[model samples]
Target: MTPMIEIDEVTKYFGTKLVLDRVSLTVNRHEVVCLIGASGSGKSTLLRCVNRLVAHDYGTIRLDGVPVDDPRFGKTGLQKRAGIVFQSYNLFPHMTVLENITLAPRRVHGVSRAEATARAQEVLARFGMDGFAQAYPEQLSGGQQQRVAIARALMTKPDVLLLDEITAALDPELVGEVLAIIRGLKDAGMTMMIVTHEMGFARDCADRVAFLSDGMILEEGPPDRIFGAPEQPRTRAFLDRIIASGRL
Candidate 1:
């Protein structure tokens, strides 16, 4: 598979506090790579840096072999190519589901409302959300809202998708439904880089799994290797803790 996203010796700092320390990784086209670690391990920060939501302090991030900071891909251009969905669902409470999904294309990409609405309806129906186009965020369940968020991200037809703990805020029963959507995306050949605490989902769905410690990748391999026989002591310890907590 061709490399879709690449990070080489990337570093990030938050007010002098080092968040990422020369981290490097690669995500291939039509692949799902999961970043797994405890909170504050820089998984989320790394995902943000990919789309320039949080600029890296050093090193480089390239999308499809082009530097992310290249002037050709202006801020909106980069975002349009790399759609992101966060844990909070980030929907506009004031807007209906259709409105929220169509906002970016209509406003930022110069898509007409009629065209955007038609596209939104098609995507929503694909996600089984066609019935809720007129509903507000608060009117939907957590799972439904999250599905809407994913649908909204898909509106831009991104080249790669970044998911940051997308199931972290859901109820246990609702988690599966959201994860199911990701599984569907994977089946349809959507390239995704995911930051997640859901170890089982990562193990089952990801083509590769990367374990991050502090701000660096400690061990990375197929799920069978990482979950079944991690070579690094730190990775073993982290998995042990997750197992003890009954989270893995």
Candidate 2:
């Protein structure tokens, strides 16, 4: 079967610095792949390239077998196919939760207001944000706003979801709520590529775990192998740090 996401020797740079260096990986349908790496390891950059948030400098990224940079693919089409959520809740502060969730569906997807609203309500209820329809971004907790962002992404019925350090901005007590929602997504067989620093969460939730260092995937395997006995010395050192920090 064709993979849902494929990256082939992809490389990216920001001015003089290389962010992703000849990286390649695949995520099959209904698979949850977690990227576990220290800061500046190109985790978020890879996801952005997948979703076409930033164009890759070399190599190719394909989604559902189509090149992401192909002219026919189009930005809106790519955005619709791969919904993304970030660490900072990117909700429009002036909009209510319902409006925020429904805006893209109604505008970009050409969904009617009533239809968009119904979809929003259903996904919000699914994510345990049922009563937050009228709340503004500032009024909700960080976790709730993040949930709203995820729900909004789901509203578009994306083929793949990209999450970039989504819990990085949340309070310790609030992290579980958002992670619980992600676990629920995994249970529902959503195809996902997540960048996260939470090792325990990565171990418990990822179908496969990849450890990246210096813009390359140093090692990737089943969670047990990658976490219990990382082969690469670099991976071992990183996990040792994670253990020292009491995260693993």
Candidate 3:
């Protein structure tokens, strides 16, 4: 079967500084793949590349084996296939939760307002934000805003979801609520590529965990092996640091 997303020898550089060096990975349908590494390890950059939020300097990225940058795909088409939620909630401050969630579908996809609203209501209800549809961003906590952001992404009914440090901005107490929604998505078989610093969460949620070091994926395997018995020295060193920080 064709992979849902494929990255082949993708290289990216920020001026003289190289951020990604011949990196490659594949994400299959209904599979949850987690990218685990320290900050500046290029995990987040890889996620951005997959969603076309940023472009790679070399190599090709494919969605279901079709080139991601193909002119025919267009920007809107690429976004529709892959939905991404960032660490910071990017909702418009003036828009209510319902309006925020329905904006893309109504404007980009050309769905009628009534239909977009119904779809928003359905996803918001599913994600336990039904009561807050009319609430403004200021009225909700960080966790609630992040949840709304995730709901808005799902409104597009994307084929793949990319989550980048989604719980990073939340207070410790608020983290679980956001994580629970993600857990629910995994249970529902949402094909996802997640870049996260939470080792325990990565172990629990990932079908496969990839250890990236110095802009390359040094090792990848089932979470059990990657966590319990990493083969590469770099992978083990990274995990050692996580354990030392009491984050594992």
Candidate 4:
């Protein structure tokens, strides 16, 4: 099977500080990959580069059997082909949840308002936020807002989605709701790349886990190997500290 997303010897830098160093990986269609690492370990940066949000200084990214460097692969390709859910719920405060989703489909895809609204309604229903369509961002809890963000991304019907520490900002009670939404997506076979600290979720959801540190992937394998039987000393030590600190 062809990989849905591929990263080859990718490197990125900020001035003299190298953030990602010759990192590479492949995510197959209908597969979920969970990326875990310390803060500033380039997990999020790597995801951003895949969709051309960061624009890597070296290496290449391919999406859906097409090289990302092709000039034809511009914002339209990035927006429609690859969806991204941010750590923060970047919803528009003024727009209602319904409008938040319809805006993209209308403007980007040129779908009629009625058609977009119909699609938005279906996805929001699936996301369990159907009734909240008319509600403004401020009217919803952080979890609700995040779900709306996810729904909006899915509204475009992307082939692959990137999630960046999506539950880090929510209250513990709220976190479950957001995670449940993601779990639903995983079960529904959305190809996903997740940078997450939620180990249990990763263990349960990911087909594979990549352990990143110092701008490189230290190890990667099925969750059983990475989470239950880590090979690298660094990976084991990191997991130990995380567990000891009561974060996992």
Instruction: Tell me each candidate's TM-score.
Output: 0.99, 0.98, 0.98, 0.97
Worst 10 residues of 1 by lDDT: 69-78
lDDT of 3: 0.92
lDDT string for model 3 (130-179, tens) is 99999999999999999999999999899999999999999999999998
Write model 2 residue lDDT over 1-248, tens digit each, in one string.
45999999999999999999999999999999999888999999999999888889999999999999887766588899999999988899999999999999888878999999998889988988899999999999899999999998888899999999999999999999999999999999999999999888999999999999999999899999999988999999999998998887
Task: Provide the overall lDDT of each model, using Cα atoms, as 2-decimal numbers.
Answer: 0.96, 0.93, 0.92, 0.91
Candidate 2, lDDT over the whole model: 0.93
Model 1, TM vs. native: 0.99
Error of 3 at 180 (Å): 1.2
Q: Which lDDT tens digits does candidate 1 get at residues 1-248?
A: 79999999999999989999999999999999999988999999999999999999999999999999999997599999999999999999999999999999998999999999999999999999999999999999999999999999999899999999999899999999999999999999999999999999999999999999999999899999999999999999999999999988
Q: Give the runs in model 3 whose Cα sits over 4 Å from its true position.
A: none
RMSD of model 1 against the true structure: 0.6
Q: Any idea how many clashes model 1 has?
A: 0
Per-model root-mean-square deviation over C-alphas? 0.6, 0.9, 1.0, 1.1
Error of 4 at 19 (Å): 0.7
Rank order by lDDT, top first?
A: 1, 2, 3, 4
Error of 3 at 49 (Å): 0.7
Task: Give residue 140's error in model 3 in angstroms.
Answer: 0.6
Q: If both were scored by lDDT, which would come out higher, candidate 3 or candidate 4?
A: 3
Candidate 1 or 4, higher TM-score? 1
